[model samples]
Target: MKKLFILFIFLLVCNLQSYSQIIFENGYFINENNQKINCLIENQDWKNNPTGFNYKLDGNQNILAADIKTIKEFGVNGQSKFVRALVKIDRSTTKIETMSREKNPEFNDEKLFLKVLIEGNATLYLYDDGNLRSFFYKNNDSEIKQLVYKMYLVGNYSIAKNNYFREQLFIDFKCETISQKEYENLAYEKKALEKFFIKYNKCNDPNFVSNETKKKKDLFNLTIRPRLNSTSFSTNNSMSDTFDIKFDSNTNVSLGVETEFIFSFNKNKWSIIVEPTYQYYKTEKTKESSVYLGGEVIGKVDYKSIELPIGLRHYFFLNDGFKIFANASFVFDFSSQSKIKFTRNDGSEANSLDIKSGTGFGIGAGCKLKDKYSLEFRYLTGRNLLSNYVTWKSSFATASLILGYSFF
Candidate 1:
């Protein structure tokens, strides 16, 4: 089982490297000298605004990288646009950082690639780097400015939020018949910012039309999974006065199916999953007992079960077509038929015991290819199957390797 798991990991690494090739798309970039260069840009489909980009000239193999300071603007055709400019950034400490006796925010000027959110009379831009998020705006090609905000420690160990952005917006863009309630309800998020800018544009010109398109909706996926399973059992029977009895691990192949419902958040990186599976095990062994003088015994066990597991999974994208994921789940197992048979050396009849239902949990990690196929390895340990038997209480454990393909 360990060898198989290692092999799976090796294959996943190879797949990841193979999927990392650059994907060129129709785009253009403005160089430092304010010249628009029509070329093919390598699109990584980044979730966060990248500090640098790669481009090729005239579909050639040679690739070049450019930083924020070297590029004035860039855009993918019908996808997105970004502009590089120097803007004042808020260096305010977070709530946790404010507990260290310093409560003032530091301000500095830096150049960054801000994503163009709404591009009309009042353009709205955004800069996000996974840790800090800041919004910028410009009016009729004027200089860009960052909306001001700060967090500071207050009395009684509390924190106060200073929202200067609200005041600035109301003072700069307030027009005839625009209510104060509209400014008060403005939030510091992408949707709210976009809506406010759109309203401003429409107020200035009744014929103003938006250039933004509707985003794609959330996705639902159903998959068929087939797995290879390995199992081991251990027990000590006090009623039979026997020492530890260890059974050799057994391996089997099984088929199962699962469905995934992906949430429409954070670039579709989160999901909920449920799977139903079937398993069977059969093993037999002969043993010599030291407790019983010159005695011999024969033991056999058989198991047939159905399992249902429900869980949550999160994905980390390595590139455009490959990602790594981790998941955890709780399982309910129903043993349809289980039997344990034993025979002793005194020419005695075989005794049979029936096993009961159980529950367990599993943790696993895997890699996905193109959001359609995946390979996973997991370990499961749980409740005793022989709890109802008088002579023994046995624990069951299993490790499984699963391969899955998404149909929808």
Candidate 2:
């Protein structure tokens, strides 16, 4: 288990460094010279606005990088766009624990790459640094301006929001079709602001086309998984050494069905998974008794259970066809009518113990191909099936080679 965990960490680090190479898409960048060069830009599906970007020229093998200082604008075809701008931004923390007492925003002038969410009569832009998200806008020939919105502490006990952005919107964007109630209810979020901007643009010109790039919505999948598990079990009586026994390891097959829900954010690189699996083990052994004279002990075990594992998975795309992922799972098993029995050398029964269900944990790493097939190496921690017994304890561990085929 320790070795498996170390390997998972090593693979995770390596995959993070290499994932950036798989997503170069057709895009164009405007340099300081005002020259628009068509090239392939690496799209990280950035969670936050980036200060620099990587690109490769046509027929070139070497990758290049450009920063906000050199690039005036860049766009990944129809997917997304960013423009360099000098604007007044608030750097105040919105966290309740460290909020300021001032109601007004503390603004500073900074140069940034603002993401274009809607580009029309009234354009909406977003600047996010993972912790803070600030919106900016510009109309006609006016200079770009930040929307005023802040959260601050009130009386050191309660929080207050300054919704000055709604007032700013009502004054700047005087539209006959937009109502004051809509402005008052507008949220300082990406989707709501983008929708409002689109509505305003459409009202002015019915033929207006929103340049907003909507993210893909395929976020669910189901898979069939089959595995070969190398399982081992051992048990002992803590009060008596004569009843202790160890079973030989066995290789068994298991089948499972998995449901995965991929998150819409972070480039669809993370997901939650639930898998239900069925497995069984049956074995028998004989050994001489330590305490009984001229007698032998024969032990037999029969166990069957359905296991449910719920986990989180993170993927690193090598390309559209291939990706690597790592996951951790908490497992719960259910079993009935499973037992271990011991008999005397004369074929008479001595004792029988009912086996109970247990809980365990697992860690795995794997790669998927073409969104259909996958292979994984998984290790499960030891579980004590005799946990219901006070004096008897058991250890069951498994290492598995799992194969997966996605149906959708």
Candidate 3:
């Protein structure tokens, strides 16, 4: 089992290295001199707007990195786009003012790579850095302006928000017949903003339309996993016995099928997962002794069970195609058949032991490649398997290394 686990790790490392290159796609960027340079841009599938990017001119090996200050506009085959813009951002404390002692938000103007959300009669852009989100817009290709919003302490203890974007939109696009109630009910979210812009375009020009693609949040995956399991257990048959029967740690290989339901809301950074898997475990141990007339004894245990693990997982993206994840799960194990067989030195069959079902927990960490394959190491500790023998108490634990291929 150890050798197999080591080989799995080796293969995983090799696969990671093989795909560890910047994914260059056909794209173009406008430089500081306003020259449109056709090149291949490294696509990171960024969750947040990037300050800088890598590009290869004419698809050559020579690469160059450019920042917002050096690039005016950039896009990846019209799938993703960004433009350099000077915008005002609200730097507000997430904590309450009583704890942070911050009464006013800091409004600063900075050059940023704003993601283009909609482009038509009126263009909308967004700047997101995980910590803050700000929106920008331009009318008729005019100077870009930031939609103002801030939270401030009002009176002695109350907090109030100044959502200037609502008034700005109503005044700037009054030709669309936007009502006061409509703008007031609008939420400061991506979907709401996109809807308002689409409505605005339809009001101005019936032929104007925007094509927006959203990623799916809910995912179902089926995985076939081959695992190397290290298991241990101990038992004592009699109270007056000088030596207890101990089964030292042993290794076994098992194949399991797992079904996973992933619920992601924060750009796949955090997710709720429920995975149910079926596995079989079998191992044997032999003991030699002079105290008994038989002189030698052998025990074999076999387990067929299904485990349901419900948990939460967090992912850290290494690049566009690879990520590392950690998870903690509460496992409920249901044993379909758990039996132990014993044999004496004379090759006589003894009574078989039956195990009970129980619940446990597991924690694991792993790396995933292109959302298709994953390798993980998990440790499981759980309730003991009680025996009918008067003095025998047997418990089992396992440490497993699993390799899985996901079918979405």
Best by lDDT: 2
What is the alpha-carbon lDDT of model 2 when measured against the actual structure?
0.86
Give the Cα-based TM-score of candidate 3 against the true structure: 0.70
Order the candidates by TM-score, highest first.
2, 1, 3
- Top TM-score prediction, candidate number: 2
- How many clashing residue pairs appear in each of the predictions shown? 0, 0, 0
Question: What lDDT tens digits, residue by residue, belong to model 3 across residues 294-319?
Answer: 78677777887877778877666667
In model 2, state the lDDT of residue 389: 91
Model 1 CA deviation exceeding 4 Å by range = 1-9, 99-106, 175-178, 206-228, 232-286, 293-408
Error of 2 at 329 (Å): 3.1
**Which regions of candidate 3 fall more than 4 Å away from where they truly are?**
97-105, 151-160, 175-179, 211-274, 282-286, 289-304, 308-408
TM-score of 1: 0.71
lDDT value for candidate 1? Answer: 0.77
Better of 2 and 3 by lDDT: 2
lDDT of 1 by residue, 1-408 (tens): 744654665565446445434567789999889999988887765667889888888958899888887899998776678999888777565656554334434668888899898888788888877767888888887889888766667777677777888887887787665679888878888888888888888999888887674666447878888998888876657766443466788888777788888876455777898888888878876677765544766667788888888898877676778888777789888888788777666656346778785788876778789878998887676567777866677777878899999888
- Ranking of all candidate structures by their lDDT, best first: 2, 1, 3
TM-score of each: 0.71, 0.85, 0.70
Model 3 lowest lDDT segment of ten: 96-105
